[model samples]
Target chain A: MASLIPLTAPDDPRIDAYRVIKERDLVGRGGRFIVEGRTVLDVALSPRNRFTLESLLLAESRIEALAPLLAQAPADLPVYTASQAILDGITGFHIHRGLLGIGLRGAEPSMAELIASLPEEALVVVPLGITNHDNVGGIMRNAAAFGADAALFDFASCDPLYRKAIRVSVGGSLMVPFAREGSAEAILDRLAASGFTLIALSPSGASELSTLARPPRAALLLGAEGPGLAPHILARTLTTRIAMAGNFDSLNVATTSGIALHAMRRTQITPA
Target chain B: MASLIPLTAPDDPRIDAYRVIKERDLVGRGGRFIVEGRTVLDVALSPRNRFTLESLLLAESRIEALAPLLAQAPADLPVYTASQAILDGITGFHIHRGLLGIGLRGAEPSMAELIASLPEEALVVVPLGITNHDNVGGIMRNAAAFGADAALFDFASCDPLYRKAIRVSVGGSLMVPFAREGSAEAILDRLAASGFTLIALSPSGASELSTLARPPRAALLLGAEGPGLAPHILARTLTTRIAMAGNFDSLNVATTSGIALHAMRRTQITPA
Candidate 1:
């Protein structure tokens, strides 16, 4: 069982990490990230996730409700409870969910290491220049849902560990293995050399998605919303189109990921 | 050519509909709605869409660049040009896109009328209790991209015509044909009577999406992010699951729609 530390003042030094959280640049806070709400916190505390808990801040009323989760935390990790007003003051926002956790991001596997670790038959999602945090989160969620081996991001893409992205992903950012390293071209070269069929999604592709034969090992290359896959990247892969109707040319990139992943999942030729 | 009316004041009576647009309940604004950004405005002005333009507001600098689109508008329609500051003052926020339009929402066909108008072989998406305007917009965008015949929303769902939804959809709300009427049960009943196969997407569904045969005419029923389809609704339809690999149960409802619609489209059998 975790020890409960009662916090009466918002300025308490131990709770300083939770202060004005919305304003703080929490993304690369010396490897620290804020996990919000009960649902996401549950995932953060799970033994399977690499995130290390620094402390937990909760509303007094929520402690009893979240006892099971608190019990799961390491005994050394402090669980602090405060009045709703003090909690709100400490966070500089009304945390309606009344739960916030400070977590230390664990070391991520290198791109080469991640690729080397993949199974003989694998499905991977490569997001290129996907700058929107929400789209990043949504893509991570889709990657996990479809059981893709990993999500590889180019340097231009936003950090999946951004708080908003993590929340949008419903803690998927932590659950799904991901790595951001190298330029788009470098990553593509590595993927191709690794015997992965690079399928690039574009409106002007050579074939409809349904007509394409499934590759033994495949990587679906996706781009940001408006710009889509860059020309060089599109030229390097087997281009495929989703066959849209009407004048609208695209679906949200995250949605596109889900559809493409599902289609790829169907065509996956598992080894005998 | 649309006539240019020079507007110098924010309080001009002619621009009343554009005043405090952010605060105004633009949805069902007595058959009036606001259209923002260049892309969406282009759709709103299209002859193919039912929206009738009340007026077009443009930043003085933008008028020259948008000459082609302005020319597409009816000659009698009023086109107002104002300085960026004046346009911002009128809308109670930055009109960064430098384009806004007040459009009169045309009559929406009844659910029965809409179903009757669909092609013999059609794909439709029904969103139940989907109150998020952005989700409604995203779903509409996906519906259009995948060529879903129409989107039917239950009365409890938020209006698709809402301004934010339109922007998020990249003006898809204006392009896609959607209607909000009846309760969940009523809409499902209508769909069944119209020779549509009702397939409710749920996490605990019995059959995987890949195994399901495409019905001649299919309607994919979706629920909101949390508190998914009510148990009774799931029991009433042929339940299907989007085989998830991770511990997560579902994708974002809009993303789910895109994936399901894409699956349905592949199996579509067009009549001779």
Candidate 2:
């Protein structure tokens, strides 16, 4: 039987992982990420990821509701139950989902290992500081769906496992292979070295996507909203601008990512 | 001089245009839409769209902030000033943007008229359901940037002008030519009749996008987030698919639109 730790106070040392969530940058800086809501935690706890499982915190009344998942946990994973008020105070944010899990940054894969994992013709989503967590998650979800071998995050992007990002993705973040590599340019270089065409998405580029006679092994590069592909990156990439009808400026980064992947996969014009 | 209408109560008959937003079907049935936030309102007030400026509601304290925009309103438009309490009471949600405007829906031109308003081979975004208002807005923004001539929303889609949709779209909603039309089939028929090859986006279907030899006068068909283009609609037109990396399922609709539009325009690919 798994041991249940009981906490009566919000500030107890046992529940430190759930503290001051509003200060996520500080928390992220410490090299830890919070997996919120029961669904996200449940997926993370699955055997494939084993994920430290650091601790599970839930409202006392709901402990039984999560019994099946709890029982599946490795014996050493700690389970903590606390009052709603205590959980609420400790979380700072509303703990409506009534559950939380903290996981160490698991293992970091090398660039070559990440590249080797991708299939010969891979579509990779390289996100650059597209800070809206939902957008990040949505992009990752699309990346996984459209045959992206993996997702590579540059320095400016948000953490893939942020609670809201994970929720918006419908648990896709956990399922998709992702890494926080340092610079987008460097990642592009690595992809290019591995025979991937770095297709930079921008509004003011010269090539239309339809005319390409052969789809190159490609990496669709996207920048954050407002600040599109950094000039240096754009300069180094094979630029293709998305076609828009009359005066539209740009699609949100996440939406843009989905469209790019779909186009990258086309072979012939089949009449729908 | 613009007159100031003081509305201390939520049910004031003059502000009827801004009521019952939570229930969108009713609003759609009524043949109207909502525009919130100062920036969107400012753009809606532009002479180009010439939106029927019904009234303006400003938090009493924000009057000074809005003085310049007020001066630009048609002389007959009324401005309503209300206390923060009354403003919240009126919108049914917390009024964060501090200013709101009610405008009659812009006069929608007939399909032919809308088409004639643009150049031949213009880009357009055709949204189907796409329930997430933010995605709709994001798509419109992309449409604006990629030079799409207009944004056409299918019958089942959420109102593009809904407060959250417009706010999330970052004012792109107002800058683009947009209107909600009937079913996707009906719209495609109209487009085909006018010489457009409607390219319906799908995950599992014909043709890789990169291999297309020629660009067509086309309309990109996009569906909502999950269950993409219905089989019936997918069967009716030129089904164009993007070739993507293997593991990804699909791109965000807005992204798909942008990428497809970019590809269709052949704006990125250079002659080999």
RMSD, every candidate, angstroms: 2.3, 7.6
B155-217 per-residue lDDT for model 1 (tens digits): 999888888888878777877778899999999999889888889988887888777778878
The runs of at least 3 residues in candidate 1 whose Cα sits more than 4 Å from the true structure, single-residue gaps closed, are A270-272, B270-272
lDDT of 2 by residue, A70-182 (tens): 87777888888888878778877666567777776667677668888887656677887787888888887676666566788986788777767766665567667788767
Q: Scored by CA lDDT, what does every candidate get?
A: 0.84, 0.70
Model 2 misplaced stretches (Cα beyond 4 Å): A1-129, A142-157, A170-172, A175-224, A227-247, A256-272, B1-16, B19-31, B47-50, B60-76, B81-86, B106-123, B150-152, B175-182, B213-216, B267-272
DockQ, per model, reads 0.76, 0.38
Using lDDT, give the best candidate's number. 1
**Per-prediction TM-score to the true structure, in the order listed:** 0.94, 0.65
Give the C-alpha miss distance for residue A207 in model 1, angstroms.
Answer: 2.0
Instruction: Compose the digit string of candidate 2's lDDT tens values, residues B1-272.
Output: 47678887978888776666556622433546566676566666665343466777788988788778777777788888888888788777766668776656656666556755766655677888888877777776666566666777777887667656766665676666776778777777777777766667776657755555433455778898678889888888667666654433445676676666666565432332
Q: What's the TM-score of chain B for every model shown?
A: 0.92, 0.79
